[model samples]
Target: MRNTPDQEKELDESPLTDGSDELYERLSLKVDKGQEPLRIDKFLVQRIENASRNKIQKALEAGMVLVNNKQVQPNYKIRPLDEIVMYSDKEAHGEEIIPEELPLNIEYEDDDVMIINKPPGLVVHPASGNYSGTLINGVAWYLLQKNKELSEQDLPRWGLVHRIDKNTSGLMVLAKTEKAVRSLAKQFFDHTVKRQYMALVWGDLVEDSGTIVAHVGRHQRFRKLFDAYPEGDHGKEAITHYKVLERFGYVTLVQCVLETGRTHQIRVHMQHIGHPLFNDDTYGGDKIVKGTVFSKYRQFVDNCFAVCPRHALHAKTIGFVHPATGKDMLFESELPADMREVIAKWRNYIANRLA
Candidate 1:
């Protein structure tokens, strides 16, 4: 159970009048001798309505619970005649939380596997920055709504086989059952899943096509970034095959195929080369250059950065074998509006400049 700060203050003020007055609420419970000594948090979870185990643990860690007028450890045992006091300052409000019925863009669905076209900015799971309204939550709600017509177990359950970054929009596959999950996970372990990406970088590539073979690890100075080291102590072998698609003055469009999937592989590899993705905040592509009268292309470059917030990259395609049916499946997503707009504007700028 949880109460807002304002609600708690109002409840406390309404019950008290004099400045020296004390307000207290007592709760009495009989301890069962047969039951083993349980942790304070575990015990509180059973007593508190609408309170989760995590919430109870936080309360215990914050010293909000007391046993027999004395603060006790989480593992302390409760004896007969022991009084438990929880100073919540106000009564907890209980509200039923129902999952929101949200629409899902499912590309393919089968007994064993499911493919989804994940949009940019939709987080795959719940994390620090995002709590509710996630792709996982939406999937669960979708399954629940489907279960009304079919059996509860018949609905397609998304056991995450692999994950894509929040900002990287593309095809993602999920498993429906435990057997399918194991089979698909084994395929990923065996390097059978083929992944590809398309990126627009800031500079032209000297070579039309090339392979970036490097040992990728966390950067020593900047923990957030990855670096390629010659010595290769703690990094993993990463291979990226890139081919030139089109050229626009100093900028180039390229398609990247991955032999191994690492965190931020495309972004890091692009930065390792002379050409980094435009508007990439992490690997030094943040400045917006407005084209002057002499350099008429500067405004187009600035507008490209203004339209796209993050790196100019997208997970274009993914192909893998279906775990349940042992059939081949391939999925793809087109460039999002932001990336498409950036490319269209850049193409127009280059055409005008050459003309």
Candidate 2:
């Protein structure tokens, strides 16, 4: 189990620095029937790759560890089929950051901009509850190591152009200087930056292509979630264009192009269209919103969830004009192993089911 960013609430903000990145980790595990009673801390150590026994104990102390939806002690024994969830917020609200040497997947970099392949579990910047071990902290460390002349005081202006959702793996370009930052931010603001995402949504879209124009704002009831106003009565103007790429009977893979990058735009827009991205828990895609009720089908869907535990979305492609060189640059990433494997599983399941 790789360390994962289980949830990112990027409402009314950039993907990377949504005003102090929030760490919202959501995890679920099903204990097998044959398992004997074991301490909850011991049980979790095996399922969560990065979770240490110490971490589990800490969670137990903080009331973050729950068994069968109820908070439990560290000594709580795991009964068969116990549902467990570990939710905690390590909020860091300091202006200063302590740099940690985190691994970075650098795709391309130059004097002006750096294109990075952000992993699924990394927050882009420091904020309340997540001041350390963020992408920014790592970048600061990397820069300080590379250039002996610069001080840590220069760390705040890393020239972040835009942000991708924490769990959304994809390409992101960061500005290395103030000039680059201004230029890239202008490009994003003008909607000239070409960006495309691959998403697996719950239901097969009725149209092969369409545009979603709505006023997206905070949900009146669920403040944690966003709602789209199609009537123009409220919210901010947002537009998303989508094209169906492949249909897997129950869920359809689609390419979403952003005309405007509002907070949670893709997730909210797709949900507004009745085709929420698969496994997006914040938007109600975690449950079996599609497919049949048979136990076999249920098992198949559950396997898919386990296969790609995060949202079925990737920042696949991004294009922009170079801020320094005045050249056009485009970067694309192949589907990650998890997304590819699950899509293949669904493809095979559909083929055999239809056959």
Candidate 3:
């Protein structure tokens, strides 16, 4: 939500020339001890007449507001004797579009970067069908009201470094400045950024630990999916290292590390090894496993099989050097409820069958 260069330039050229067009009312307030911080928009709403949250947010993003001479985020806490300035422009009012407040799970943050625990089913950015309520939009509103400043080209992103699949839940990092963005992007491209994942796959793996080295490319038959082979023109080298954590009667829990990132690298590689992730229909597991004994125990198996909504994969760990300070940083996310439920069901099935 910071003022981009374009917005700042526009503000400087206009400079609240007419008092009639200026809607902001300047005020100073004392922050009481033990008072919880209020959102800038909420505070402004209470103080200003007929000012919508969206208007306050846009005004803040246009650099029309200052907190003690420093532009702070919309959600910034107010201390005692804090000076607040609001710059109002009628031109900006027409363009002030209010975005929805989507749910976000922010794990860690500082001036330079922020780390978020992105849950499954949430798109990272807005697309054609999904125009509102994406992570980027939320971050935009979050930053704008915080009174941060950014350049026009970087306005869409407040230092976003990389992305994960919409269906994949895990920890992701965002940059707060252009410098950090470039630094982190270079780290990812140079293969210095480490990422690890946890998955539950069908069948017991033969090896306790091993690596998968193959060339991966889009499937010839299915454009949506990727396939692996020994040779191909479009193929890119992909490597995955996996360690078996536990074994159910038919399924196994695994931890995988990526040496080279490709589209669906883990899922494709696991499927290539005859261990397609449980409930993964994209790589072919739509129907329940069938057999003579399976027919007899179909009901029991179906209950366990229904646990996973999609592929049972979770990004568990990430490591990288700090883009700004050059310090090493690592983050980890525990298994989500859905994945845990899948494991629990598998355990029950195994115990009952073995017993």
Models 1 onward score TM values of 0.67, 0.73, 0.68
lDDT of 3 by residue, 1-355 (tens): 3334543332222111121111222333333354457776677776655678887786666455668767777777676556665544323222222345667788888877888888877777665567666787777777666765643334434345566667778888887864565456545545667889999887888899999987777777876678887564555667889999999857899999987666677888888988888777787644454333556566655666666677788888888888678889999889999889989987887788789
Which one is best on TM-score?
A: 2
lDDT of each: 0.65, 0.77, 0.68
Stretches > 4 Å off in candidate 3: 1-99, 148-158, 289-296
Model 2 misses residue 256 by how many Å? Answer: 0.5
Decoy 1 TM-score against native:
0.67
Q: Better model by lDDT, 1 or 2?
A: 2
**Model 1: per-residue Cα lDDT at residue 20:** 8
State the lDDT of candidate 2 residue by residue for 1-355, as single tens digits.
3323431121112222222121233455666677799998887787665567887797677565667868788889999877776653333234786767889899998888888898777777776777788888888888888897887877643355567778898888888875566566656756788989999999988999999999777788877677888997766678889999999989999999988777788898899988888999999889898888899999999999999999999989999999878899999999888899999999999999899
Q: Where in model 2 is the C-alpha error above 4 Å?
A: 1-94, 156-158
**Lowest-sum lDDT 10-residue window in model 1:** 14-23
Candidate 1 overall lDDT versus native? 0.65
> Per-residue CA lDDT of candidate 1, range 53-161, in tens?
8765644554545677576767776664455655432333132222455567798887667788887777775545565676766776776775666453343322665
